[model samples]
Target: MWLNGLNLMDLLVKKLFSYPGRDFKSGRDTFAPFCKLDAKLNHPHSAYRTIHIGGTNGKGSVATKVAASLMREGHRVGLYTSPHIFDFRERIQINGQLISHEAVHRHLSHIFEEDTESLSFFSLLTAMAFLYFREERVDWAVIEVGLGGLYDATNVICPSACAITSIGWDHMEVLGNTLEEIARNKGAIAKSGVPFVAGPSAAPFFPQAIHVQRHNPYDLENQEIARAVLSTIGVHNPKGLKEKPPCRFEWRGDVLFDTAHNPEGFLRLLEALEYHFPGQKFYFAVAFSKGKDFQSCLDLIRPHAQGIFALRGDHEKLVKPEELNLPIEETLPEVRPLVVCGSFYIMNLKPKKGRETLGDWESDDGILSIQKRGE
Candidate 1:
């Protein structure tokens, strides 16, 4: 569909992004507009039970795993994530299936009919997800926080269970400078009667919530957090997450792709790589956004990487690879095992050929389209 010489999706994107940046213009009432919009829609989020997941890292994985676990219990599950790698629909899914273009168009068109000028891009999408999930009659919706928890747009919902996977240093500019400050901000999603779960690292911040102990491999710790969240909601002995989320230490052939953009995430990724591939040093291709502590990430990857290839993409937020004083590469190395890690935008540097299709797990659109629009 075309609207005034623009693809319908493009038109919608423009409208949604008009309110740029994470904060609303009137900072006094951050979530008031979202709450009013939800009330007007008869509070669609209340139509289904929700589990809110928040953290600096691993919240997406935890949300996916929690949704997958709920599915194992014979429930129709809706998973809402953020920062889509390919298509916007990837951020909203039901039973591992991306929301259809028709559904996005329908819900967004309806949403645009209202006074939505005050909403942020994430808030609009979160509203769309609530409406879609309600109409689809989902048994449960796993909502992932787009940013800090307290004032985040997704915090409008009163969830049955809330979990924060880990507390890290990313988003310090908005969340806080210290780990405790960050954890408190993310932990604010915990309501009086709602069950709250925290990973081993985030446990100290929320002594009232159920605390998950650390596991050896980083992946195991995430799985443990998911399992604990499920148990609180009466889904005991549920079958765990079958597969990892897209771009979370995902491997296509001998090439590994991970979106570990922050220092804490980098530490975990490197530790996992060492544990999984002992005595094997792999080549690295890396890029990062401007605000991230890329030096810390690079320092972590240096010892484990046999060779490093700094890559730059067209995204406005990405730091120039050459600025790091490393060898910049137009193409990834043809080594036996090459690891590509950093910002989500770096995925643009990946070749389409020889790439492993997500096999119905992802939308068919290319990353170039989203990146071109600076999404």
Candidate 2:
């Protein structure tokens, strides 16, 4: 219910992002060298198993689903994600409950005693998660890579299972300009022994890196690719994951949300929906900032969507509504529902009467319905 951001949370964010210089050092070793500090960590006492998830988008969502399902399966699950919208503590969850602020401070304070002046904030937190998870003796801890995979601090975990959600162009300055370069960064999270499950697409972290579907034969567009990976590994039914928390096509009114900031990820989202749901009407919520390719993403997914909200969120990195509001296809045939897929911030407007999530599914208010002057 609290909407205001926290001062301490802001401080930690600034501190973690403080070391831009380190990200530029070496392409391959750029992110990993920081992990050497793990030698000093209390690894002997660490009892937490892990699942490392990486990708440009969908990493968080996929990790959330996996962690949630694990918790629902009676496992002691801890989910550590990033870039929280409402609260910083949302990043670290135990059995679906966020680690308390008191716990965060206690952990951070204890770790700060280690003379971390040279350590990035992310490195410290990764250590803290390991320490906390060890203390809690969690069955599994789901770790979402902060940026590129290999060098990311979270890669320190020796996870039992892992996944690369969907790779695309993001953090280009740190990861790389090309998708192949990016995929290499993320692929570092993949180990030789673990079953690496990937989304049905190439990622900028490893743009040129191809995943040959070593597990089972599944249609890439079906979005069952992920489900199949889970099943093949015996994690699906062995832990009672069948009936609870299924891989969903829609949420809260058949609305779909994918952090497909890159063209590749966007294409996959559109394709997966078209394959899984077919001609069913869809509501999309997309968020991106100024420097991103919002235009290309919109163009890629436009055909599959029956309605698009082009949402705007509360993040400072979000693109403004006026700037995102581009000229429409006035005479353009309605191949799909009329909608915009921009920032989610537009939801700040009070809901219209008689709609499900926000009501008033008409063209007057939501971004999908906004008509250009020529239209």
Candidate with the greatest TM-score versus the true structure: 1
Compared with the true structure, the alpha-carbon lDDT of candidate 1 equals 0.81
Q: Estimate each model's TM-score.
A: 0.90, 0.67
Local accuracy of candidate 2 as per-residue lDDT tens digits, 19-50:
44233445345334445556555661247677
Per-residue C-alpha lDDT of model 1 across residues 322-344, encoded as one tens digit per residue: 88889887666566578888888
The true-versus-predicted C-alpha distance at residue 14 of model 1, in Å, is 3.5
Output the number of the lDDT-best candidate: 1
Clashes in each model (backbone N, CA, C under 3 Å)? 0, 34
C-alpha displacement of 84 in model 2, angstroms? Answer: 2.4
lDDT scores in order: 0.81, 0.55
Model 1, poorest ten-residue lDDT window?
A: 366-375
